[model samples]
Target: MIQPQQQSFNQKIEVSNNFGIEVYVKREDVLHNEISGNKFRKLKYNLLEAQKLGFVKLLTFGGAYSNHIAAVAAAGKEFGFETIGVIRGDELVDKYLENPTLKKASENGMQFEFVTRTQYRDKNNATFLNQLEEKFGDFYLIPEGGTNDLAVKGCKEILTDNDKMFDFICCAVGTGGTISGIINSSYEHQKVLGFPALKGDFLFQDIQKYAENGQWNLVTDYHFGGYAKINDELKQFMKQFFKKYLITLDPVYTSKLFFGVINLISKGYFKPNSKILIIHTGGLQGLQSNIAEI
Candidate 1:
């Protein structure tokens, strides 16, 4: 099993503007090299629990260029557990030639098993697990997006004991597990904010089901087009922001929502002098993979 490493606490909060919002960022971006960002926080306990449960092999689901798959493969190699990736679509045999994420996963020694788009759609169905067993034998299967109770447990630990209480906290919502964990970890006085990247079909309702107390808000306009989709404005903002602040934001998850937070603050939507904390879920490896296209 892969052992978890010590987390580093870096950077500090400062007043960058006169908007009265005390914006602070938790640098989850620098968690590790290959095992970077939110993936580490989400995967830490899952790996540990899998090991504790006597699981020798780890199985998880992801797409052709999934950050979760990349992290799982690297973590499995680092922890000595055999890793298998149940990839979406039956194009694995033809994808490695051009798919950067899959290429990196192979370099990390992860075995790939392809499933049809139809089969991958029903991840919770018994037939999927049966097919996995028939192909690669028994293994601990992690849900796609890494949103599990164990993942929530690990993410809640992101907030250390020394953090000052804030009136509100904000983060991007992908699988809703991290948001659920943040809501669980925060005090009653504080409110949790979720900016959703996936839209349509009552997304916040699902997130609310995971979070206790049902006190969360979604900044729905920031998703741009969809998951991993970006435009000129987002790319320009990312470049300029990095140039000015030396902090990087990936187009898929963190950057767009953070942009929304700042936009709202600038528009005077948030009350003056509000203390806000933004969680930086990391995906630079995936960003790097898209350098040419970006």
Candidate 2:
């Protein structure tokens, strides 16, 4: 069984004093250069279980710039499994070089199957899965965004006894697996706040399926026009944030999480002397896709 490196918590200096609240970030991004952040946690046990089940190939779904896709490719290479990425957009097939995320995954030996967006939506349908099984021939399927019961089980290990001092736990929600695990492991008095990168209320229902506790809430106001969408304001914020704190946040997930946490602090949403812990769910590889634009 391949094990992910354990990470430690680091305090943000300037932001900690803002609004009289102390903020700390768990440096899950530094856990691994390729398979970093929540992706590593989500894939940790899934890979183990696949190996235990005597599976040699791993099949999963993701978008053009999905961090999960890149992480799975790297993990498969490291753990001796064949990887197949069912990409969302068919147009991306001929233009993989233009997208760094896809390029990296391809370089890591992951086979790609491009599908239309409408067809991709039926990824969980039985008929769709049956077709994939017939085509791929006996492979373990990991859902899009890597959210599953085993994934949530791995995520629960993110928080530990040392995290009990925090009043609130914050994380970026993609498929809700990471937050679900944090909510399950958090202290009773601690409130889990999820800043979603996508715009929609559907995540509430998705998360409710896995989270066992009622202490978590989704902050839906900071998506910045939805998934993989960004603007100059968000770009400038990330640039200055890195300059000040020396922490590079990806435009997809961690950026929105920090943006929401800071905005909530300025709005007096959190009480004074509150200790807030933010999960830095890394998607740094996605930064390469936006480097030219941002």
Candidate 3:
């Protein structure tokens, strides 16, 4: 098994004194250029288990510009496992070359199985699994966003003894695996806040399945429309944020998370001298899809 490296220690983000909060980000995005951020964390143990179980191929599901898909493809290539991406949107199959994320995954040797949106929603259905098994032969399946028990186990490692000082832990929520791990590992006094990139409260239930404690809450106001949805205001904020922090936040996750944290700070929601640690879950590849817009 190839062990993943630990993330860098606190990289402080400068904030105004009026906010009375100290913000620091754990640089999980730089953990690896390809398999970076929570994607790496979620996949770390999944890959090990797959290899141990004697699985030769790994199959997963994702959208057109999913960082999970790209990370899996890169990890599979590096670790010697055949990878298959059950991508949503059948139209993407013919336009892979035009889509940077899909093109990169293909370059890394990930086979594509483009399914319609309706079919993609059945990704977790038993019938879907049976069909995939018959079509692709014996393979280990990792769910979309890689949020199984093993994936959450890997994500729990994102925080360490050094992070216990923070009063609040923040992360962007997608399928909820990453924040669930954070919630499980956070200090007793730490309140973990999740900013969902999608516009919905359903993630609260999804997270409940894995979180071991009640020290977490979902801040659903900063999705900027919905999943993979963005606007001019969000683009401008991202540009200003990058210019100030020298850190690039992908529109899909980290951007929304940062935006939420800052908004909360501005509203004095957090008490004075509060220490906040934000998890930078990487989805940088999603930026390529919006290059023309931003």
- Best candidate according to TM-score: 3
Write model 3 residue lDDT over 101-170, tens digit each, in one string: 8899999999999999999899989999899999999999999889999989999999999998999999
lDDT of 1 at 75: 92
Model 2, position 292: C-alpha lDDT score: 15
Give the deviation of candidate 1 from the true structure as CA RMSD. 2.6
Off by over 4 Å in 3: 291-294
TM-score of each: 0.92, 0.95, 0.96
Model 2 agreement with the true structure over 1-294: per-residue lDDT tens digits: 667665656666557445678888888888888988888999989998998999999999988888889999999998999999999999988998788888888999999999999999999999998898899899999998899999999999899998899999999998899999999999889999999888899999999999998598999999998887899999999999999989999887888889899888888899898998999987798888773110
In order of lDDT, best first, we have 3, 2, 1
Ten-residue segment with the worst summed lDDT in candidate 1?
285-294
Candidate 2: what lDDT? Answer: 0.88
List candidate 2 stretches off by more than 4 Å. 16-19, 291-294
